[model samples]
Target: MDDNQEASSTKRLWGARFKSEPSAALKALSRSEPSFFRLAPYDLAGSRAHARELQRAGVLDANELAQLLACVDEVEHAFVAGDLHPIEADEDVHTFLERVLTQRLGPIGGKLRAGRSRNDQAANDLKLYLRDKARTLATAIGDVQAALVAQAEQHIDTLSTGFTHLQPAQPIVFAHHLMAHAQAIGRNVDRLIDWDRRSARSPLGAAALAGSAICRSPELSAAELGYDASCENSIDAVAARDHVCEFLFITSMLAVELSRLSEEVVLWSSRQFQWVVLDDGYCTGSSIMPQKKNPDIAELSRGKAGRLIGNLVSMLSALKSLPLAYNRDLAEDKSAAFDSIDTLSLVLPAMAGMIRTMRVDVDQLRRHAPLGFTLATEVADWLALSGVPFSEAHEITGALVKFCEAQDIELGALTPAMLAEVDARLTPEVLKHLTLEAAIGARTGQGGTAPARVAEQIARLKAVLDKQAAWAADYRGPRC
Candidate 1:
């Protein structure tokens, strides 16, 4: 048959109840082929498993089931190789697959639709697709974390000014700052693993909002398709979209973490900071300005975070008011989710490359580490350790900083006479603790920015990353 004839044959799927054909406007408005066509492989996979269930229940005899399975495998191969595609009349992946199956098997192909509805089929296909994508995303996040850990190891002793309110607050090891981002990303991977466990249940047997009479064994299909179990309630199986929303939430959080790290990349690469230099391959130049080499990867990463957040909001809004069973509004979930998956797939690798290639300015970082009187806190600590009340010690440190600021000298530049003038408590011994090395070394407590502590933190982070890698590998094994 011609393309039009084949498409018209499929259009009769729901035509018996209607007196006339659906209007052109309704057809155009209801079409979801573009957003959901990518679910074709997953739909076919579910079909093969459902076919086994049908055969077990005597809905299709052994010979007919064999023919159905072979045809499904052919359609799946054609779809993957780009030899098959949905025509304009195909409303979604389900309709397109059914049309192809019918064309291959004649009347027997229609029998596969006996115990299911588009409602449960779409739900099953989406869960399978997202479960696979989640594994891929977790693996990509591990790449970014690996880049950060490698950089942190290289800068274990490099000193930089740690900031609060964008002003220097203290001296810190540069590795400590990089590892902080790595820690945040590790948490994002944890969220993905947790979400996968909760969403692994199959919705295949939950046909049309009520239990199916023809196909009695949802558990058989669930096991065949590698699900944890069949869903407990058919209505909840078809209507609930919390899994999609949760995936969006996880990706939104992942984007925000990348954006935070990207903002720092932008700031550090600027002339004012000079703390980092971007590799030429990862940066972009202006059309007219010869001196312009911008950190475009970082900038784009920051901008894409807003799109992820918007996708999460859109998914949540679409789900807030819908009643039980299935509704047409569920179609709105795919585009938002697909856009998030696509956005992250593009952004994650670019970020990993940018981070892996950048150069750090160790001299620049050291020069500014002690410039803002960052050793004032150390001096106060010394006074407190000497039996002075911390409140009084804070007052003494403030007075000393004020005196140095008026004289236009840094904390390290003060003389013994200057110490005596500020306070009798500020003896010559106080200057010993004022060095950048001493300041960084003093914070040797757990999770501190001290060199030894930062090294320990990196080792711990590496252990967690190794665990995350194993999880991703297992998740992508045979079931996926």
Candidate 2:
């Protein structure tokens, strides 16, 4: 068929002026396109608002506007209640809904598209969708942070060996380390709240690339859609995807933080560490080995983080070279945008569950806390407090550590005579800094891992989390 006949053969929403319909493979790609499907709810909202404006402008009488809103509501209700499905010829959600409305409401339904284009409408839908999803993700992160805080409070005085480069370095409690993850999650919560506020601007009136001079007031549409303001310029409104990029970055960073905690879960549950035991409900058994119970939840979360990072990279790559104004390329942006939110939504709750259920082996923690001469720093600090030059004290502590290692004894296992062999500064009084408890207790500086400091941290974190909870709740809170 010739181009005009070809275009006429399968009628698309943007089919006019096109000589031929897109190639079959290209046309089929629309079904997989997520932008329109996800935008349906917001698109209906925009149409109702647009219809009222058209009536005010005398394009539609009051009866026509009322009829349009009633039809829009019917389509929305059917879609939500699972009673509506588009026909096979429907190419995209925008066209599908418009087709359904046109079929039911006759010519008046076609009048609804007089001053708007899919360009601005899709952008509007995206902002609405992400603003709501960001709030949900923030609340999930807060839940995970709360789990960590609750666990930390339980372990405020439980001592464990803190590692540097996977080797024992000093003594700290389980509460201090877990709360570090909670603090990181708190930042993620902040980012989501911050980004949601910044991204709530509306782009509905930016029809096509520029705008229609006679369209309804964008301010009114924006207010109805819950946006803080309308986009200042039409071009930037539809053309900009920086908000999408920033959201992807936030979710990707959140995944990385969760992966770090997952790694710890894997390590702590292992035979060598024995620091924690995962609940049977959250773990899986090996297929071939009857004796094996694995940390699959943590392992899977760690693997999924790579996918989240890849999604951010894909989103950035999609937008990097697109020219000004909207492009066909942007249709691909939805997958990563949606997937990042989904991935974090799934991972955060799993992490929170694991944190809530794990058993901490206190005896193992205390026993391991003093192993590998982890208290060398404490002995050096004691010498420094005894009025010795820190450099000399450091050397003296090193000598003591070496002497202990030569005899195959820990720093705390050495006697007064054995201590004197290393240096005169290594007195029986130095024994005060030798136990894991004393080593942990001696450091009472702010932000230290000392038991008292950890208690203070528990209080501070609760305050931060309670404030974050309020914001996340507000973003998705109750009406009125």
Candidate 3:
């Protein structure tokens, strides 16, 4: 081919309607190859499906369909192997792939664009990409849940302080605290699964707002691409990005949960708490300090939550006040979604490893479980159970705590005379309930810190993880 022929072939997809080529500034400002090229495999998968639809519509013969499908397969393999890329003249994945196809099959490949537009193509590719990614994220979330369950099972009878407003409020089994994080993670998985249900619809046949007359059967393409159903409205199909917004929200919530767990790991590993020991592999050392180990993984996870949240906000802002059918502004969605996916990919594995390897200071937790007059609640409950009005019992318990604070003694140190002086109803029997063992055991209600209840909670969360594992394992789709 001559230089002029090669240059003409590299021109934009719709240049025939205009007298001149687009300005360099417009091309530079409108380029999306860097962000959307990753969707090449999905785009090829959609192309193959659309190829069959073309054959059904008589736009292509059986031989042309065969050739087109084969060429699409080649393009996909080259892309996956990193042998294909967009040139300086290509604007997006669609332009680059179409250019490659036209160069290979000449005019036969041009028939593939008969009933398709970049608007529907872009929407379809993102759905396919996120559908596959959601499965991966569910599995990753399960890995973190497995780490939490392992720690919880190992510490079922272990004692720890339960706090309200960051102040010691009661005694609880350590497993209960770990299971709290597991519960939050389980909800995240549920949200992801629910999000997939709405996102599984296909927009491929919507073709720039109105339904395609040439390829009148979108159901065939939808089924071929593993979508649950074809979209009900063509304009809504290409214009709506609420699915992306929902995805951002779901992932942002997951990041928020990881951040909360990370904060606790940071605090518990500090010298002030000394309740957790960081594994060397998961921790970082300071340059200047001779003795410093930092929970950098946890800190990074916490920081990345803000980034995920910003991605959600940015996508929402981009979608605001845009007209229907399709707009250039929708291009902003790719970067935000891709960034969230990338951030979670980096964070989930590190979080699972850090939790799985870190050592909990069981002895320290046990030693401090009964400090800060944590048993005062048991005394109040005892009085409430002994026919004393709860209001009166609360006052009496406050007085006992104040007296103990002045005397600089624990609840166990109070004598019968001192208890009587504080409350005439304070019999020797009240002392029996003050023990830490009794304090933890008394919480026998469902979802409580008692050993039996903690055991039940573990079993419940494990059942949830098992279902998520099965869902991820059983997922089947047209993946490249």
* Residue pairs of candidate 1 with colliding backbone atoms: none
Q: Which parts of model 2 are misplaced by more than 4 Å?
A: 1-11, 34-36, 476-480
Candidate 3 wrong stretches, greater than 4 Å: 1-8
lDDT of 3 by residue, 1-480 (tens): 221234346857677888776888998898884867999899998998899998999999999999999989888888788877777777888888888888888888789899989999999999899888888999999999999999999999999999888899899989999999989977888988899888888998899889788888898888888888899999999999999999999999999999999999999999999999989999999999969999999999999999999999999999999988799899888999999999999999999999999899999999889899999999999999999999999999999999999999999888899898887999989998988889999999988899999999899888889999998776655654
Cα displacement (angstroms), candidate 2, residue 22, comes to 3.0
Q: Which stretches of candidate 1 lie over 4 Å from their true place?
A: 1-6, 476-480
Query: What lDDT would candidate 1 get against the real structure?
Result: 0.89
- Assess every candidate by TM-score: 0.97, 0.93, 0.97
* Error of model 1, residue 464, in angstroms: 1.8
Q: Residues 199-295, candidate 1, lDDT per residue (tens digit)? A: 9789988889997887788988887777788999999999999999999999999999999999999999999999999999999999999989999
The 10-residue segment with the lowest total lDDT in model 1? 1-10
Query: lDDT of each prediction vs. the true structure?
Result: 0.89, 0.81, 0.90
Cα displacement (Å) at residue 382, model 1 = 1.7
